[model samples]
Target: MRLIAAGLLLFGTLAPTLAIPPPTKPPCCPRHEVFTECGSSCPATCNSILERNANRVCPDICVRGCVCREGFVRNRDGKCIPPDRCGRDGHRPGDSSEEESGIRCHRPNEVFSECGSACPETCDSIVKGGSERKICTKNCVIGCTCREGYVRNADGECVLPEECPRHESSEESTKCAPNEVFSECGTACPDTCANLDDPKPRPCTRNCVIGCICQEGFVRNDEGQCVLPSQCPNSDAIASSSLLLAPLPECGPNELYNECGSACPETCDTFNGLVENRACILLCVPGCFCKDGFVRSKDGQCIPPSECPKPTGSTPTIEIITPECAINEVYSQCGSACPATCETISGRSPPRVCPAVCISGCVCRAGYVRNAAGKCVPPYECESNPECGPQEVYRECGSACPPTCRNVLNPNLEIACIDKCVAGCFCRDGLVRHHNGKCVSPKQCRIPIGIFTVGSSEELNAE
Candidate 1:
């Protein structure tokens, strides 16, 4: 009881002191928001911007430690250096011991032998002529400096010399129409339409920089004359509208509208259900193409569909048959109604394969597969390997034969099964024979284009 009373007395004595919590650790310095903490330094050259923002908390240790400011990087001595000096060693820019100089400055990439003048506070002191503005220097030091991709203009501004207005030395007049200019070197032509979607990375034709070039709103015509955008016959209605004139017929992102006088015939008018061709747009002039299974011949003609070689690997060969039904009508067997397109499948019962020898519902669109539900689904949604038994391993699920005959996982099979279904596994590596049938290597399995029966003797013998 006496000890309990003594403990109570001690607690009462220290309660007031304990109640006073230690000072809350201040929040990190606000300037630290922009600066990264590199590490400790012996002679710190940075100043604390923490006082400027009341909400900032100082770091527990190294409260005044060195930090790299925005656009500046930290050096070995924990000094904040300009971006140029980030990887450089032992190169302090403004460490001169010269006398104080009066204010005068050079823009970026400009330098003198010494600190001949203090850095200018503003750009107004240097800007001189047409469309040019002054840009103040980031550093005050002067030395033998190399400015890349830029030259000091007469206006005392460091600017890119390329594409700048060039002075013509020849007395001959090379005047162009409004919105056009004469250049010593010009490019052939630019595809104005291609640049509509993305302005960056616009194509460059030598006609502009090499010789006389039309300005942004103008294009050169057949007579080699710079004319209004409307005069450029190649500019289609949609392109013209995009350029802000009249609206015209619109094509898919891949398709291009060709005018009457354009080069290639427009065959894409008929909907074939495929992406437009890239080569067709280039060679055929006014055509919307880069058709599938077709390549542009050296003579600038699209190779006929029948002449194209088969695509290698497991890519399915689509059998396209003209149906007896009206144009755009889905094809089906002679008696049964053609399976509906996937677009209509949800509204009807599961569809069956159109008759093989005869017309069938329109061939499923590319990248689609018939699922176990008898519904059309994207290939990616098809069930994975399903036929493999307990001993077999499941690899990829698809509508073709796996490489191995006796699936490492499904040993019960008498013949290799290559059905489009939930997939089954092939024999494990180095296994010579399967428990039930011939041992086939994964590489030996070949899924040809078009249709084939699953577990057929022909397919097994071919293997």
Candidate 2:
């Protein structure tokens, strides 16, 4: 009886241990995989179609542990995929296949390849017939290449080498002088010594022109020769050289000879406000100009400015009126180019660096900025606007890269933040923006699935 009681007590203690099943081992099979006691010896894979077509055989056997689900095969990445996607080619959809047997090249006499030459012979290269050898890169590229005895044409089609179009040589029937080169497309406004010292900007036709152009660092001279800029004759030398031809004609009173005179000469009729804003061609005109304090008469004679004719109409006294301005605005002869607006009233924006030129307009008064309604308002009024949400403050200049729930937990993440400020509502201090565009405390921030917590709240808050 004593042995039976001891045995019963021992069995009772062991029964509880046996009743609790062993902690189930975590599943080792990844996604798209299942544990199997008996798996196919030769399961379908990315290369199954090619292998089957080659009459490859599969031995009757079992593969235990894990296998892909039905109708799915393992790709090169060991991920199960559909049978139709087996032996798929490029990294993107609709791309040409790299498989030798399944490739469907678009152009004739072309074949697809997994590894081909980076630089292939083209029709243009063959037509040019240069003795220089092409330096091809060794990097492998997956694309279509022309078959033997064929080359890629300009139209991106593979054609026989003899079918390339012939181009006329630009140098044929054309001769280039020293320091000049023949170009199929040259600039219409070739640099010349006459215009080299001119400060005005000139417009030229944007067209492909065939002609001879001066070589680099050289310009054309008046004698039609390409020479270095230092070799060009100066103004005094040119004037002395021209003296050999003929003496300049004598000028009238208050007149002088000008190699390049103003096209819009000041005349008696236009001395006043008659032609104040007239547009004239900015070109050099060789003629005589009036001396200082003199104007040209209609008879082409220079006279004193005081001798110019006056208008016969009666003069009326005109009153200068100041423009009426809205509230909080004042009329000024000069206004800020970078005007203060609701978007720039926070004083957090960069300092305004406006040009010294005056801009006549109605400008906001001191400590005021224009609002969305085009009315000048105080900075405090902007802060009181209802555009800001709860726990968010409106800023004229706010951080472009604001803290969000996606990056709040991982503040050390590298983000391309612009240095400039943006106008928007931003989260207040000790708060972060949520994915739903609401502001909340860091502790209340919900971490994304892939991101895990690293430390306690105090450590994160301190950071």
Candidate 3:
């Protein structure tokens, strides 16, 4: 009875300790920062306007960090500041005052501008006479450019059209070979001996191309030499020569000799299925083809469609032989052109647009992706997203624009985000990513203290 009483006393002493849960670790962050697991890969900064206007592509990913509180953007010094004060101190490019002070037009007939034309007229462009279309970017470019009627010369100086140095005409310098001639624009497809008698009008581009071609009344021969039509070998002579050289193969019954035959000829086995969907090459094959209303049989004999053997049942049982695939993979006759690989699955570099084309092969099944070793596996099994940080979980298709401390307070920043999902680590609900790389509640985010300045007086003086 004494021993039993002692055991009961020990049990009561340890009961409370065992029932207690582990203490949660508080997030560590600097002043005015809060932890978050799902932060914008492309966070809004003082240069966000410039980057967005410049058409910079932002990576689709969720980053973990301690970001600034709402109604703020990161400045050059990594401090949160108001959006209105982004370019007030002249750090931004193309600033009016900065352009005026930094660039000086020393050359004659030159002027400076904050937003200059991207495609400025040059001596070379003037010489081309607008033959080629110039693709210009619709953005502000700060630089010194030639004045109104002047153009930039090869020596990098602005000059009048008449004052620019002249060169010999390209047509005068070009010397055509024996049967070739120079032309400002030439036919893309030239006539040859094979197509000389063909009545079909070949499709060609209307664009002008300058190059040498056979003289008028001549065509390229088999040896690639320009020859007149009278000098070309006659069909009878060529046929006789070929017969003397080698005898032609005897065609089977109902088959005829054809120089150009359909590569995907109708067969007894494929007449009901593959023949309808198969893609045939434009190039023709040289062989004997079966007569109309007949198809090649399994025994290499041509037979009528009605004479072909029919299925025994009303519903034919097509035995589809599925290919053996690796783990988490499935065979598909028309698979996606862009399959989910390790890089795409991890959102390292996902395709912006996938072509609508069919590719036959073994591919990863739904909810699975291919790994680095080329084996299909579940998305969670991928090595890239397996090491998610605290309070974060791996997602195959998370939001491209996740809520961060910078947008958590406002929640309606007029930033355009791609309407696509990305694979990455995302924070749990009610937690926001802080600038210092931690996940914490939104209320824990601290508001920045004191007024923000661009730079110190000493630094400005040094500059």
Candidate whose TM-score is highest: 3
What tens-digit string does per-residue lDDT give for candidate 3 at 143-258? 57788899989888899998876644566555666676767567756867777656454434345665578887677777666776555665443343343355557898999887
True-vs-predicted CA distance for residue 410, candidate 2, Å: 38
List per-prediction Cα lDDT, in the order shown.
0.38, 0.63, 0.62
Model 2, runs deviating above 4 Å = 1-103, 131-135, 170-180, 183-463
State which candidate, 1 or 2, has the greater lDDT: 2
Let me know the TM-score candidate 1 reaches against the reference structure: 0.18
- Give the residue spans of candidate 3 off by over 4 A: 1-265, 269-291, 346-357, 383-418, 423-463
Candidate 2 TM-score versus the reference = 0.25
TM-score of each: 0.18, 0.25, 0.32
Off by over 4 Å in 1: 1-128, 134-463
Ranking of candidates on lDDT, top first = 2, 3, 1
In terms of lDDT, the poorest run of 10 residues in model 1 is 42-51
Q: Candidate 3 at residue 220, lDDT?
A: 72
